[model samples]
Target: MSTPALTLHGVGKRFGDVQALHDVDVTVESGTVHCILGENGAGKSTLCNLVFGGYPPDTGRIALGGKDFRPDSPAAAMAAGVAMVHQHFSLVTTMTVAENLLLTQHGLRLRRQDLTDRLDEIAQTYRLRVDLDQQVATMPVGARQKVEIVKALLRDPSLILLDEPTGVLDPAEIDALIDTCRAIAADGKAVVLVTHKLGEVARVADAATVLRRGTVAGGGRMSTTSIAQLLTAMVGRTAADLDPTVAATIGLDPADAVTHRVGAAPTSISGPDAAEPRSITTSKTSVPMGETGSTASALTRAPIVEHGAESVAPRVDNESGSAAAVLTVDRVTVHRADGSTALNDARLVVYPGEIVGIAGVEGNGQSELVAVLAGDTPVSGGTVTLADTDITTANPATRTGLGIGIVPEDRHRDAMVAEMTLAENLFLGRLGRFRRFGLLDKQAMGRAAKAELDRFDVRAAGPWVPMGSLSGGNQQKVVLARELSAANLRCLVAAQPTRGLDIGAVDFVLTQLRRAATAGCGVLVVSSEVPELLALCDRVFVAYRGALAGPVETSDPAAAQQISELMMGVAA
Candidate 1:
């Protein structure tokens, strides 16, 4: 056979005392989609970085087509017929699609027309749809992802790596991506798909490899194994069946629970200094049912109502007693830079132990809502109360001090400082943990950061490397590790907490959100993906063209459908 497209032998990585990947070996055949499966911190992203030359491995040899291959940087990797489409879009928003696509043109400047024409041809040929003339920022998330793929394809790579390509896509968009991947493989390029979603694996992958604690757990053809078997290999256990109590906690009507995943793993709360040899269990330890006083606060009604029920009685939690709201927003209006309205008189509330989801189409004020909650932006007119304290006028720092942690919608631009070290990034504003006499305690910070990194499974070249150096998926883990470690948090504002994470990471993040709720903290998660909202939130509020259409209880289909239509701005 033609030399394996890419191979790694005795690959390993370590940070101070943690061994991220150890004596790992993997081989990818030409023109086939190879999958890397693992739970959060399983070193999936680490392996990708090493392959792409983000940095050299601590110990190992990488070969391409029977020859030793070593790329010094991303540019070198591209030169060696390897390309990566990061979990985060790397295109500059201000640049036109063509300009970004052929950015490196030549040592000398090239004609813009030539670049655009060539880009158009390539786009059409690959069936990767994108408008060459459009400014990248104007495109939706799914479209932007397409641009990233186009950029990679332009390099004419023989090996392509897609890092969590479906994380930000809607259900329909995911289908398109699946088709695109199929086409890419058909082109005879070796493809490495790094993701944690088992469904995605079942849908598009050919052969599969499982990584656990930085080592290869197993490998097999996708067609020969079941999703449950994959999960067992990745997490080192037969994945736990969803606890019936979890379905009740999320207010899933028993009927609805049957269709969706119930009681999988929870989101991760560990920091960057997480231990090496990551745990295989993806689910967080479940909060004892009703411990947060949520047992009687909400009721679950069947998705289908009995024909004789009078007007469908509202589900009420008998155990939930009247309690002061921790977060309250009233008649809030958000406006664009040009004075156009984004959110008009929208209102919402969340009590402690409640996880509220705000769902809408892209560009429908979801970003604005997250900004306002995180105190990154000021609302034009509204009341925002946190623990009965008016925080409408608070700054981002103040809100954070008041015990609100935010996993922003745009992890790169809003949440992370690219040039900073992992340790510094994690301790962004809260330096108390590593400050001495008002001076930064470097040693303490590194140690602390290492602990969180291992705990959260954040993959990076080194703790001190610039944040921008790691893969997008790993960067997201850094953001999660930092924000969730806030000990005094009373509430959290997470916008797409699992945006670029793999299936294992997805489970870890959801579990963390549940943990926060169980600890009596209020959580407001805003996402465009409806299924994510359905799976994680205790209640969902639909937004349409900036209006708070309806706060739907997740108990029945009628309420969810009503909210769904409102999300489309349809009349009830």
Candidate 2:
């Protein structure tokens, strides 16, 4: 093909002692979608950063159209016709969409009128629509992501790097993104997508590369590779020993069930950002650790699920009085602090010993529902009953007291205080009993925190260390341990619990949630990942336009397809 659009030879990167990427080689031709697939810390992001110049590679050569290419910064990369759309948005939450759009161009060169006109022109040209005057903070997650994509496209880069861009998008929005990439490729641009979601890779990738432990495992023309082959490559397993997909492809075989194998100390790997690479922390809680590839880890890590995530397990109705619901919401309505209606008569129920899911496009009332259930938000109407007690007006503390535990959507903002010690944050809400004679008992709290953290196997400098000192997965472990282990925790609500976690952490969190349900806690899992919801939830409900749809049983073979239609505003 006419000189590959981008190429790397023997590229390597290191963050301190972590070798994030080693001898990496990749090439992208124009007019194609090249997918870089890997588990978290598999060096995907490091490669992207290497190419984008967030940090220079430790060793390597980069070429653009057969010419020497080296960039000192992201701006220089963009100047060379490369743009990156990060996983998390970088927009000014306070700015109007139109303003954000205009700021990218030369300052003072375009009037507001000109910017609006440009937005309109691009909307028509790209077949993408966005509200120009709306504050990004108020837009739905899907819309905000669309704005991010538009921001990257506005620069008209010849090569685009998309990092987990569809993590928060709905099926329709994801399809739109794929179509846009195709349109861009048709115009001879190159698209490099770095993602852990195997289904997306199977659907949109023209060529694929798999990374494991910062090294390329295998890759080839997408047409020549089967999903099974891709999974085998990504997880370092054989077709028979292949695990999750192997089970799903035939049928879930408990005898064949597998978990992550024990991996040693944190190695050099790509992490959350360019400055810091990821590290591994072994949790030694009571829970049995899985092999190198645990069932949950393998399933979430690979494209094992036919629909792209794990599918249903038998509903476990093992709680006392199993038929009785632990939590119920009747016609709940919620308004945002900004005065926008968030949930309109949203309703659902969580029965003991069962996992229920709230599935929808991001920004479609899932967050509000979680807040309302967690007692963090005030309701405008409707009633929430916890074990037959009216809790609509209960405060967060009251909810917690009534056995309502939440692993909030934003763990940092709602679940834990980053600046506080891990012990302090773990026992933050339930500190009343720790006080003795109106005086705080430091020794008692320390002992309790250490015992509890050790039980959850949360690795940290010590219980005295800041909560933020741990990795994302370990941080999540702290949350899961606290909530699930709470006294009289009859029900638990977790929102996007695995949102930013790696496969190892994802597996651990899901396992904990399941065990909590098995032990009689009603569990509510709110996530944008349909595959996850399909795989783990016993029952799934679609949240759309601030409303809850049918509670589809996950046991149905077509559950994923049905959920997709419901999320897209169609009745399954």
Candidate 3:
């Protein structure tokens, strides 16, 4: 038999008091896509880092192509034919894509034209196109993700590790990435996909290993292992114990949601009312997985909806439409830093006690809209009002003072400082509030932060730990805890609130949003996941080409279809 592409036996890693991974065993053969599946803090990233040489294992052995492999650094790993695409990007934000790629080359004096040609060649071969001269900082999260993929591919490694690659991609982009993974494996290379998304595993993975709390819980060939088996292994719970909404969110059927047979016909998994499943496909003619059909079909479908009438959590009554609007964007127009129009004639209204959602493909003016609302970018034309007060020209600090809380999309870059402690991050913009006698009252701030962290169920060492030390989910919780705890919060603009969270974390965050709305705070969520919008929002809108579409009520049976059409610019 041919030697496996990679192997790990009894691998264990520890950091301080935390056992990140322990007694783990895995093998990846050539010409196969191996998935590392687990929830947040399940040690999936740790395992990937161990292989990519981001960190060293405290025990056991790893081999690459039948040879002992102990790479002290990422450079050594790359030299030994291992490349990695991190969940959080690793690009120099100040540089262009071409320059970033050039930095990864072996020689320091390589010509730019030769590197560009090589990048173009790899991009064409893998269908992973990226703008060569685009600044990494200016690109959207999805675009950055593509650049990362292309950068990894440029290495021409035998094994590539992708950590949560699809977390930021749209449905069409996701389909394209899956195709890319398949192509890479077909070319006799090994692919290691680290993710918590079950639908993705159903589509692209040849085999999977489930991790729970730093140990291997279950694993096998994708053809044999059932979705229920995998879910149970990851969370230590049966399908019945799983929340139906979460089950549907992650691409498992609420009833008999077990097997996701690849290439099988669409499965009509019953929704709340057991209505017939509707046929919905993405703009790329691919079906989205985990909605009402097979994983592939469900993933390709654009309109994510329940089989029957739209069922959402109980929300405060806003049907009267008589209440004064808490936030209003009237014909708002925003210009990009380059003087190009980013948002044009965009109008929206959010009343008190409502959860409003904005859904669209990335780079469709969503970021612009968020920025305008957050008071980061001034609107070139039109008025923004908070509770009948015109604040179109309000700055970020002014907006925050006016009870407008913002949870920006890029949490690490725009929301929190990684180097700061949890207590400091929790009170980042509002440090003045904790002042005593013209001095920073750090002790009081720490005590308050600890209370809020406990309230939000944030798992961390304490308020003194650096915010970067927390898991993605825990970090998000800290952000939410800080924003939602505002003394005068009236409206919240949360962008991609649940982008990379685990199932449990997703549920917690959504519940908090709902709770905030119930407490008479207007909530606006911007997300790429249509199903998430459908499940959470009372009314959903689509942002396209710097414009706003319908406020499609979630109660409408055809809401998903309408939103999908609006996103694709084909709304009737």
**In TM-score terms, which candidate is top?**
3
Q: Write the per-residue lDDT of candidate 1 for residues 1-572, one digit (tens) a residue.
A: 67889999998999777788999989988878888888657788788988898988989899987799888898888888999988767998998887786676353264677766766776666677678789988898889998888878877789999876777775557767777788888888889998766656656778888898888877666555545455556654333333222232223332222322222332221234322222222222212121111111123221212212212222232223476777888998888898999889989888887788888777788788888888877899988888867888899888878888889877888889998888888889877777799898888888888889987777775678898877566787788777778887888888877665544455456656666676777889887655456545667887778887667765544444555566667655
Score each candidate by Cα lDDT: 0.70, 0.72, 0.79
lDDT of 3 by residue, 520-548 (tens): 89999998877667666778889988898
The true-versus-predicted C-alpha distance at residue 185 of model 1, in Å, is 1.6
- TM-score between candidate 3 and the true structure: 0.86
lDDT of 2 by residue, 344-461 (tens): 9888888888888898877789888888888778899999999979999989888888999888878878888899998788887777868999998888988888998877767676
Best by lDDT: 3
Ranking by TM-score: 3, 2, 1
Give me the runs in candidate 1 sitting further than 4 Å from their true place: 1-4, 7-23, 49-80, 105-117, 241-321, 396-405, 410-490, 502-509, 558-572
Assess every candidate by TM-score. 0.72, 0.78, 0.86
lDDT value, candidate 1, whole model: 0.70
User: Which TM-score value belongs to model 2?
Assistant: 0.78
